[model samples]
Target: MTCQELYIPKSLANLKYLVELNLSYNELEGEIPADGVFSNITIQYLVGNKELCGARSLALICTCLCIIIFIYWRCTKPTSLIPGTPSMKEYCAISYYELVRATQNFSESNLLGTGGFSSVFKGELSNGTFVAVKVLNLNSEEALKTFDSECMVLGMMWHRNLVKVISACSNLDFKAIVLQFMPNGNLERWIHSSTTPYLNLVQRLKVVLDVVLGLEYLHHHHHQVVLHCDIKPSNVLLDEEMNAHLSDLGII
Candidate 1:
């Protein structure tokens, strides 16, 4: 086949005593069979098929297979062996693979927002619990510190006006904090979105009051005084009932 568009039949490898196969100048785009007739063919017989690859293609396939296996192993492996702190004991431990599955491997569509040191994604756990996963950028030393700060602060505190911590996944390579998922999203969206219904004066007042309560608990009610260095409309999230809850205490 000269200048024709076709794939070399893999069955050709099964032919006994078959030799001198010439598949030059054809649109053969895939791994060449490494058996039988193919094993005997030289570069001359398969010349001009730029898309055709041999050992390189096999190596690529092998690499892809390895990646798939690695992903599968991560997903199936249990996180029970990982040690947890006293605060972590209060909630169920989550594995890195579960977070991967929950967020569809951190697909762009599942992303809720991006910040300086991390990105937030909406996900659902295997137990059907909806959660917001704040994955920290491991590359940044500040992000690592943020992860530690949030874990230390959120794990010990609980207030209705504050977003609750579900669990956390921390490893040398990856760190993520799981928090209660707010369906209504942040206060910034409500204030900025032209498509959605605008908040009335009463609703606005209630939202402000909710934020004040959350801040009050953090500043005074807790056993230790915690300062929320960053407080903005975007940092305030709303639950299903439109009740506001302050979040993102990474800099606490």
Candidate 2:
């Protein structure tokens, strides 16, 4: 057993950044605390340790997920599912566990940036695909409303220039939206970072064009007549080819 079965306090349940439980070869036994600390440290690595025998945690989780999925599947009349095809729905409703894993327990080192509503962090999934997670700690009713409003608006736009929303997770009062990673980071940094070359007028003009084109599409082709309510240099992102994208479209 290579993990620590510490007395995971229930008070720490809201903290999403705690990772790594090296309980290794401990003589601790008898029904591990199932919530808070114990719940997160579910992976008990047992080698030649006999004191590790206990009720299986994986079974409980599987059962819970199955139940939840069943209920959600039943209640939510999925307006998705194309005719005569697989139901591998796009824009999956990301789970808390997935979000945690992606953000490396939401570590600050993985943090890509921050803004008025939340902070953005760079993360990679089990599949190695990099993603950026925007986490907003809604401390008040007003913040929650704003979060909901932004989420609702961003959830609809799928334009090339507009920022893309991969998925979202709301768990334990923590709200987060996962987006595809912009390898070059924000356009503001790319154009201004001392480590990078400064953008000439031509490059800047191209970026503006891309940003406006995205907004135009949102205004016209998008499902909703969306507005790029918040537009600034900091909100633009550049791709590998220097193709500009308008990022972070929150609500008014």
Give per-model TM-scores.
0.64, 0.60
* TM-score, cand. 1 vs. native: 0.64
What lDDT would candidate 2 get against the real structure?
0.66
Relative to the unseen true structure, what is the C-alpha lDDT of residue 108 in candidate 1, on a scale of 0 to 100? 94
Superposed by TM-score, candidate 2 places the C-alpha of residue 182 at a distance from the truth, in angstroms, of 0.4
Best by lDDT: 1
- Give the best candidate by TM-score: 1
Candidate 1's residue-wise lDDT over 41-92, tens digit each? 6555676777877773555456557656855664344321223323656888
Q: What lDDT does each candidate get?
A: 0.80, 0.66
Give one digit per residue, the lDDT tens place, for model 2 in 21-98: 455565555344445444545333332234443343454456557656854553354232224321214567778888
